[model samples]
Target: MSNGRKNSMQRVSDSPRLLRLGAGASPARDKQWFCNPGSGAWPPPTIPGRIMMMNPDQNSDPLFDFADADDYQRLRDLLAAAGFLDESVLEAIGINDLPDLASDHPLLLDRTAGGSALHTLIRLFLMEMPVEADTFAQAIRPMAADSWLQAGLVRRHGSQVTAALKLLPFRNLILAFDLPALLQTPQRSRYVMGIGGSTITLSQLTIRRHCRQTLDLGCGCGVHAFLAAPHSSRVAAVDLNPRAVRLAAFNARLNNISNVDCLEGDFFGPVAERQFDLIISNPPFVISPESRFIYRDAGLEADSVCRRIARQAPAFLTEGGFCQILCNWAEKDGGDWGQQLAQWFGGSNCDVWVMRSESLSPAAYGSKWIRHTEFSDGETGFSQRFHQWLDYYERLGIASFGAGLITMRRRSNGTNWFCADESPERMIGPCGEDVARGFALRDFLETVQEDAALLACRLRFSPDLRLEQQFTPSAQGWQVSGSTIQLARGLAFQGNSDTFMANLMIHCDGKRTLQELLPDMAAALKADPARLAPLVCQLIRKLVEQGFLLPAGQENES
Candidate 1:
């Protein structure tokens, strides 16, 4: 580790206000709903409103063994038949979040319209509401609601049964994960995050290449692992949190996914001697100064967990294997950000690419995470956490922090490459193939080192490539002010170009090699072919590297 990294880590560990927990605090203090700390748990320092809580009671576990094929399929059938599994159904009901759904919504207003099972199930499970035991039983009939009680899914209070867990509906799959504080429940520490925008983004960006083994490091509820299972012969989903492991297993069962093996251990710990062809992690990448939630914060100073994962992943990847991560890293006060990240891959023999989506200053970044974790706690508490977060960042000398996706491929040959660039403003569709193609292109470029070699190969512009022209509307007729080229499909990239280059790019229809096209292009431009050849070749390399143009036979491979 560098001195800068050591200083940052020291700053996090030296926080007098939050470095250690109260001595007398016990896991037994909280009820059965608390998460078990087991051996790896690091309880957060006792802030007035932020004390960590955990309950080891086995009865608190959700009853749905969503892992059982027959039961899970039956449950899926019931959810589908009841119309509770659709994404649009929640939107139609105006149920964006738990607090948004009004008490007077039709689902709540008339719980049993034709004795609707969907309505009953949604109210009881998704909404975390109480229902009469008989009504609940009637609603989930043929599946038996008593089975839920025995599974610790619901608890009976007098004649009413209250839900203990939430089975959220995600794209053709049901995920049973933890929920946050509601009107009745206290602020939760054991909250297991479910399907959200971050998870979806990571999933969409994940490459889908077939592999013998895949690993989902820090697999929270196993979403990434679940996505990898079908394409991989075996997948190891590892997490430090036992609760997360259990919940992930439950989710796998819920979806009838059979190939994932959920293991409870920290990053790379459980799979010490094992290697994989693909590895994915939506780890606790938040660079928090203080630990609050286990799902989001690694409790390390700066982004140490992300740094360690990136640096160490190569050791656990097979030759030509790829490791992808969604992470955040600090932009230190006196360090070059790119080089700081480049150092993580030092001596790893891996090709690295980063697509940064956003960057935030210390103040803005602290405020965003503070608000996310403390929003339900009320404004006064939120204000305090936000200030403390900013103070911590200042002490650590983090000027700004960047969030991005990183992909690394372990290459057997000694030569390696590192690319750090901005991603598209908005991702359009599944660009996993685009990522794979980019890596393949990088490998090909490594082989075709000479300019003459590249010129001899045939190339063509991508079908999704589009040319756009911009002009200033003045007294002079539409004078060409500027022009740009864009990609409409995967990894959308837009770059400004001159008319010659734009036309030059459009004209390459894969019919001729670059050496053949240069003479005709130069003749059409009324420029010397000798002078244009080098410039056109240089531009072609840039365009091809950015995915604006593809080599002739490489188009179908994408």
Candidate 2:
């Protein structure tokens, strides 16, 4: 951490720019909190399985109630019947209100047909449009409209019924998140988030094997924890925002996910002295000078969240466990980024793989986030906030910010490796399996260091691996540019290749070991066996690591 970050941390203790966050402040008054439907005036009610700030109150709570399993099942059936539960249906209807897109797209024009209970629910929840009182009542048959009003999920205006939360479909699950436009309101800081690109990316990359326990740190809407529930015996999800935890708890129940335990507190504060087989987070990792929102900004200076989490994660991980997180790191003035990241895992007993997806310049990065928060250029203090963000980066001597995924595995003994590489822009399909295979290959390389040892191992080309040759018609008549070889699935690695290497790949059919193929390969290349041996060994290692080739037994795994 830099001196600037240290100073910033001290400044954040009483940051005038920031409002009081969940510190006895009323939800309606506090900009850092969203209205929790379940709480009352002063200290909130102590709900079961929740850590609440206690103060015995004369008035009973008037707002939100958690949904029961029966309500959830009815809700699920209703949504599924109406086709609102499928991602394709939502996409076709242009229901994904991502930032900067026109919300009033034509597809949503006729959404409120009121043809059935599902359409009414979709119009009410998905479209964020108010439905008629009688229709809304009939749509939610078992659960009355009065129940929704009491739960703070809806409000009544004349004969209209309006929803407070946005119930969006996410990968075979429905998540009730704080409204996206809520951030633009006066109370704009701590709205629980809906499914976005980052959330989807983190879930896709998570290793999904059955595990003893999983921990989702900074689990805003508990998407990761909910997804991990069926795969793990138990899931403990923690967040800094109380409102977020409440909503997450609601989502878990709405989806009838019984295994997740939602807790409220700062990072690692709620789940102390606990170990997990898999630990995952898409934390507030924005490299900003100010902490406007708990979901996006960590407030611990530039990239400190990433550094702190990586360092602390090892102690909480079981042997051979995996801790995966999506993070951003500032590129320091004098140091290399790879080395800077490697230092994050310095004292940990974990093998780290930092797969960089993109690097953004200060201006571009600042503008993107500003738009995300819905702060326009014409807004008051917009210039000050934007300049402060840029000045913060410049003061730290940061050239750029690297955004990527960091996957770490605890290795009890042996030498730990820190590998940093750029990954493909678009990863295809479920890549958790590819990530696991890559780790196995890395471990194999570590053990089989010698050329002889590598040659003894039988290798087969990955089923999805492909080799393509490109040529262009020039003055020399169709000269070849180069041969490219890559995995067609998962991480989608593409690289240059040659005729000999291509042929070598074909010969690696799992039946023959590299040592056996060496004599024939040398003869085909008109070279000595000693020279071909080293080249073949090196190529095999590279291919295996990239998932273009797999060791014999491993080919059957994925």
Best candidate, TM-score: 2
Tens-digit lDDT track of model 2 for 201-221: 777788899989899887777
Q: Which regions of candidate 2 deviate over 4 angstroms?
A: 1-63, 66-70, 91-104, 111-114, 377-382, 471-481
User: What local lDDT does model 2 show for residue 257?
Assistant: 68
Candidate 1 residue lDDT tens string, 446-533: 7667888888878888888888888888897777888877788767777778878877787788998888888888988899988887
Question: Global lDDT of each model?
Answer: 0.70, 0.71
Measured by C-alpha RMSD in angstroms, how accurate is candidate 2?
7.7
Candidate 2: C-alpha lDDT: 0.71
Note the clash tally of each candidate.
Answer: 5, 3
Clashing residue pairs found in predicted model 1: 34-55, 63-151, 66-253, 66-254, 67-253
In candidate 1, which residue ranges exceed 4 Å CA deviation? 1-70, 87-115, 182-187, 376-380, 469-482, 523-526
Instruction: Report how far residue 346 has shifted in candidate 2, in Å.
Output: 1.2
Give candidate 1's error at residue 233 in angstroms: 1.1
The predictions' CA RMSDs to the true structure, in order, are: 9.2, 7.7
